[model samples]
Structure formats: C-alpha cells, structure tokens
Target chain A: MMKISMPRWFYQLASPRWFYNFTSKLLPWFGIATLVFLCVGLVWGLVFAPADYQQGNSFRIIYIHVPSSILAQSCYMLMAVAGAIGLIWKMKMAHIIAQACAPIGASIAVMSLATGAIWGKPTWGAWWVWDARLTAMLVLLFLYIGVIALHAAFENKAGADKASAILSLVGLVNIPIIKYSVEWWNTLHQSATFTVTEKPAMPPEMWIPLLIMVLGFYCFFAVILMGRARVELLEREKRSDWVKQLILVNWTQ
Target chain B: MSFFLAALKRELLLVFRHRSDIINPLAFFLMVAVLFPLGVSPDPSFLSEVASGVIWVAALLACLLSVDGIFRSDYQDGSLEQMLISAEPLWMLVTAKVITHWLVSGFFLALISPLVAMMFFLPEPAYPALIISLLLGTPTLSLMGAIGSALTVGLRKGGVLISLLVLPLYIPVLIFGAGTVQAGAMGLPIQGYLALLAAILVFSLMLAPIAIVAALKISIRS
Candidate 1:
C-alpha cells in the first residue's frame, strides 16, 4: 500500500508542465459549474429568498457579502500558505500562485467591504463603522494591496517574492487577532455565528443559497486563477523547451 | 547589550546630525493636528473632546512620515550593507535602529505633545495620559514602521507606499492609544487601557524584530 501511494505521489504532478495540463483540464469544468451555480444561487437569493422583517429588501446583499467576505479571508490564507510552501521548498511556481492570488483576493475584499457597507446603511444607520470585523476586513484588503504593490515595486522578481512572502506571514498573525478582537476588546462589533454550539441565525432556506454562492465563488476563483497563472507561465517560461513543444507542437497537431 | 547601545548611539547621532530633516516630520504633525480643528469645528468643547484623537492621529501620521528615513538613510549610504555583514545578528541591529527611531520620533512626539495638546484645548487633567499614551504607543509605531520601511526600502516612491502599507497595521495601536485618553475623559480607571497599550507594545516588540530583519533580507536581496 505504501509503495502504491509513493509511486502516485512521485509522479510528475509537481512539475509545471503536469500542473498546467491538469489545471487546463479542470478549468472548463469549474467555469461551467461556477456559472451554473452562480445563476441558480443569485436567482434563488435575490428572488426566491424571503426578505428580512428588519432589513427589508436590503438583506439580499448578504448573499454577495457573506460569500465574498469568506472568500476574502480564505484567499489570503491560501496565498500565505502558498508563500510558505515557496519559502520552504524554493518552488517558483508556488510563488507565482501566491502572486496570482493577490489581485483576486483584493477584489473579493473590496466586494465584501462594498456589500457590507451597503447592507450596513439600512441596518446600522451609517455607511461606515469602526467595528472590529469591518475594520479587520478593510485591513485585509490593504494587506492584499500591499503585497501586490510590493511585488510590482521591486525590479528583481525573486526579491519581491521573498519580501511579499514575509509580509503575508506577518499579516497572517493578525487573522486570529481580527477574529477575536471584538471579543477581546470592548468594541462595537457583533459576535461570531456558525459556531458548533448554536444553529445558524438564518433558516436553511436562506443559508442554502449562501453555501451555494460560496461554492460558486470558489469555482470562479479557480477559473480565473488558472487563466492568469497560464498567462504568467507562458511569459516566464517562454524559452523553455517544454512550453515551446506544448504550444508549437499542439498548435500544429 | 553593548552592541544594542552602540547601535542606538550611532543611529541617534546620524539622525541628529541631520537636524533640519528631523524637524520636517514634527512640523507635518503640528500642521495636520491643527488642520483637523480648523476643518471640523472651532467649538472649545468639541475641540477639547476630539483633541486626544486629533493629536494621536497626527502623531501616528508623523511617525509614519519619518519611517522611510529610518532605514533609507543607512541603506542608501551602504551602512546597512556593512551592518548586515557584521558579526552581530541582523535582528539586533534592526531592533536597535527601531529603538533609536522611536527615541527620535516617538519620544520627541511625546515631549512636544503637551504643547500641542494645549493648542487643541485638551483638558488639564487629561494631559498626563495623552503624553503617556504617545510615549507608550510611539515605540510600537516605530517597530511596525520598521517593517514597512524594510519592505519598501529600495522601491521608488516608497514614502507613500510605506504609509499605505503601514497604516492598516497601525490600527490596533491607534485604537488603544485613543482609548487611553477617552478613558481618562470619562473619569474611568485608565490602567486597563494603558495595560492594553502596553500589551500591544510588548507584542510588537516580540514580533517586529524578526519581521524587520526578514524584510531587510528581501530588500537587500535586489
């Protein structure tokens, strides 16, 4: 059993050629799935879902806000983990994946902040609040932008990668602080939901769409990341024989 | 211990030798604090109420303003390269630089804050807490700002980029610093607030040296 597993693991999956081939196969499926679920979930959320008695029609923003907020945090974590891998393994591809995650993560963070603020206007009586979670999410956006800017700011790519990786690691320490800041300090922010001890505040009729939208966002993220990474790879590896063979050979075939 | 002291002394000499440059950030701090009261409201009650916040905000900005110069001077002059090649660990040198920077920027901010505190018509009783808060808070600002300066050391237009990079990380310090004065105004025991501010200072102390050193490695790699 160990031998069988080892052979499969030792196969060329870590190679860029294999990874790119694999991602290409996976992209179309994710793209279609993302569109299908996004359309279904949006219709269900905006049309079929019940309006909150308190927030009225504005509650519909939750479908966009929740998924993007979750994605914003997760993308940062994912990119940081990739950066860690790059640091440890000296894997150039891992750094590229981490780099690709920045703009995408920043965009999601912007979406979350925008939707959260829009939702707040109806419920919280203000467009902005210095609440723990909102402020934390805003910081997350800035962190993403910082990493992207640092990446572009350096003339040497390797220098930029290492710098950004370290910065992301530092920012990762703040994630827990951001999560518990409200509880730890006497701040004007709400407590967490979706904990093990309590049922979700919303019914399944509402939560199901949120779950679907999250899935759709994940799929969309995968599609875009692959598209971006492929372009990056083509530019970085233009002189490599495998890339030349893959494109030139495949084009003629 | 001597290494740290020596590094601190060297840094102070370097910064003080350029006394004219040191005053620019201080002036910016004063100007920014004054601008807020002018733009917002002239009402004494209102100015007094927002005075701590206004002062803290300006000090934070001032600290950020001086951050790029922290390592940029040495890095540009190639002293950072020599320091990196030294027998001492780079983290110690980074910490010393940060400490010296805090001494110059944050400590000076504390000393002058009483005078600026008066400009905003801050309550007499609240003066001690305001100065103390800036004193406690500015070291953390220097440490965190070192991380930003380290990250952006070799970049063009690094000053603005450093501010953008550093401001978000500055939020916790701002929150607790402002809380200290706010608590004082409410006649509440400010010890807890000060303790929280101290906790942040300690936390940054433990973490920032490594980050600054790591960022220096990246910055110097190019």
Candidate 2:
C-alpha cells in the first residue's frame, strides 16, 4: 500500500509557528491592498458614482451597508467551516482562526445593522423596521455573540474550542432557515406602502464602485483576520520554544 | 435497540424520581401566561389578539428553563463519561435523553397550554391550532435546546448561557407556532402554518440528534 503524502502548504497551515511566520510576511501586502482599495472605492463611490434618480444621495449608503452585510454573513460561514476543520482534524490553529473570526464578524454585523438603520431612517422613514433582511442581520449578530459568550464561559481552552465548534455548526444550519423565514414573514405582512429603495438593476457606472467596495471589504476582512489570527497563534503557542524565542527577540530589539 | 430503550427508561425513572423537575417549568409557564393578562390589557379582544404570541413566548422560555438540566446531572455524576465509553452510539443515547426531556417538559407544556390560552380568552376555534402547534413545536424546542444543554453541560454558568445559545435558534419555531394560532383566529387556512411547523419539527428531529451527540461528546471531553 502506498502512503499518500500531504501537500506542503497543508502541513504548513497545520503548524501555528509556520502560520504565524507566514502571515507576518503576508500581512503587510494585505494591509496595503486594503488601504488602497478602500480609499479608491470610497472616493469613487461617494464622488463619481451616479446618484439614484429616486433615492438620490441616500442610496450611496449601500456601498458601506451591502459590503459589510455581505462580509458579516461570509465571515460567519468561514468561522463555522474553520471550526468544523478544527473539530474534525483536531487542529489547534483552525480553532484559533475560528475564535479570531467571531469578534471581527460581530463588529461587521454591527456596522451593517447601524448603517442599515441610518439608511432606513432616510429612506424607509424609520430607524428600524421588522424587514426580513434587517431582522436576519440582527439574528446573525446574536448568533455571533452567542459563539463569543460560549467560548468565554469555558475555563479550558480545548473544551471552549470544541463546544464553540459544535455551536457554530448548529448555527450554520439555522442561518439559511432564519433568512428564509424572515423573508417569508416579511412578505406575509408586507404593506403596500412604498419602500424607499427597491434595488433595481444599475448601470456599470453606478455598480463599478460598489464592486470595488465589496472587494475592498473582503481584503479588509482578510487583513484584520490575519492580524487577529497571528495574535491568537502567539497566545496559544506561548509555551513553545519558537514563540518564546520570537518574543525574546522582539523584546531585545 | 434494547440499549436505546434502557437509556430511555433510565432517564424516565430519573425524571419521575425528581418530580419537581417535571412540574416547575409547567408552573413557570402558567405564571408567565397569567402575567400577560395583568401586565398588558384585561380586555378580552386585546388579550385574544396577543394570545398566540404570548403563549408561544412563554412556552419557549419554559423549554429553555427545563432543558438546562437535561445533561447537567448526568455530566456531573460521571455517567455521561461511562455512556461515552460504552459500545452503543452516543447519538442514540443522546436522542433518548432528549426524548425523555420532551416528554416531561414539552409534552406537559403542550397539554397545559390550552388552559392558559383560555385565560387570555383565545378564540374557541384557535384552541386546537394552539395545542397542535405546541405539540409539534415544543419537541423541536426540546431537541434544539438539548444541543445547547449538551454543549453547556460542563460549564459553571450553564443556565443563562443556554438561553443565549438556544433562543435565536428558537425564533422560526416561535414564528410558525404563533402563526398557526393567529391564522386560526383570523379564519384563514391554518394548514400552511401547521405544515411548516411540522416541517421544522421533522427537520429538527433528523438533524438535532446528530448535533446533540457531538455536543455531548465535547462537553464530556471537556
């Protein structure tokens, strides 16, 4: 019987020391990319993108709101997948990444909710409505907080990791259901009152900046995730020689 | 099959021995239901309109309250560790515990909800819908809450934490359970809402046991 060798990158990812060192080298590039793209995207979106004929300037909130909302949901998916990997493979680094993700995802969910509310006040004539998409976003925020709280409640790190992994997986199953049910409820009770923004098809001139913003948000998420993951790696691997030596070197320097 | 039955019988015996465990959540449910009429409006029309929502919310809280103890005693007593080491699959054992929990807490809640419903002057036609929805929805609540219980079974602060973890997942059940009764009250076709509740119940039945098993293993390992 032939034993198949795993890929070099796969082994590297499994090692916290390797991930920490690798991410340190890669972090600056992601940071620079995030900064440049965000600046360009915000400028293009705020200054150059044609205003909506109906919503006028208020529609511009979509640049921030949509990207954060998209990132929030995607971040949760990533967190659960990382958690599942950790649980299946017993990879400590995977758990660390999952832990690092919750706070960032939660903050982004908050950003999305706040921006949506701001946009809603101007467009929907209220700061909040029990709209389907908004309600799901709120639930997503609660789910993130639940993961965070469950992780904090455990005294043992490994126990915390496994418990939270199970929770996030369960939550992953509920996300789609929550999304669908909220949408169903919204339509069931939908009043004929005019919605401020109906998200019709947009020309490239308007959508291009929105695309850039979305990409920038992803890059931004990657940068912060790597930064947090690096810190987590250092904390979890603190007892190791490599981490101790690295810390000594930093202190001497 | 015998191992499953034995586990179910053991849990039933344990629950019956501590009768308060079975009765307290029911008492809590009645107290909560009673408070709505006093805290809100006494008008029958207003109470009837809010009846479904109030009952569903209280039932959800009752489920949450009872589920925290589902694995707490076994996990603390080390029997959960023994079960983990046994030859039978953890899924079967965990499912049996969840079933016992539903029988004690959710089943009684469903049986007693109609009496509480009448306090709010719920329309006569909506009574069957309320009872049927609870019957279907409460087990799903117990099953889902079991996952939360299993995860937090080893924790020092398990009670409040279980609610935080489980309540968000409980939203769809709450929506559909209340919707069934509301539809009945308004003279609309309730089959759709009841069918959705049953669909959710079926989905939870199929998937929640697997999650509960995994969660119990994690808690036990911890």
Please identify model 2 stretches exceeding 4 Å from their true place. Answer: A1-6, A187-200
* Candidate 1 ranges with C-alpha deviation above 4 Å: A1-14, A124-126, A178-193
Instruction: Give the top-scoring candidate (lDDT).
Output: 2
The DockQ value obtained for model 1 is 0.49
Residue pairs whose backbone atoms clash in candidate 2: none
Candidate 2: TM-score of chain A is 0.92
lDDT of 2 by residue, A1-253 (tens): 9977878897789899889888889989988889988999999999989998989999899899888988999999999999998988788989999999999999999999999889888787999988888888899999999999999999999999989988999999999988888887884222311123754367877777877888899999999999899888888788999999998999999
How do the residues A147-173 of candidate 1 rate in per-residue lDDT, one tens digit apiece? Answer: 888788888889988888988887887
Q: Give the TM-score of candidate 1.
A: 0.92
Q: List the residue pairs that clash in candidate 1.
A: none
Candidate 1 lDDT at A17 equals 80
| Ten residues in sequence with the least summed lDDT for candidate 2 chain B | B213-222
**Local accuracy by lDDT, each model:** 0.84, 0.89
Deviation from native of the Cα of residue B67 in model 1, angstroms: 1.1
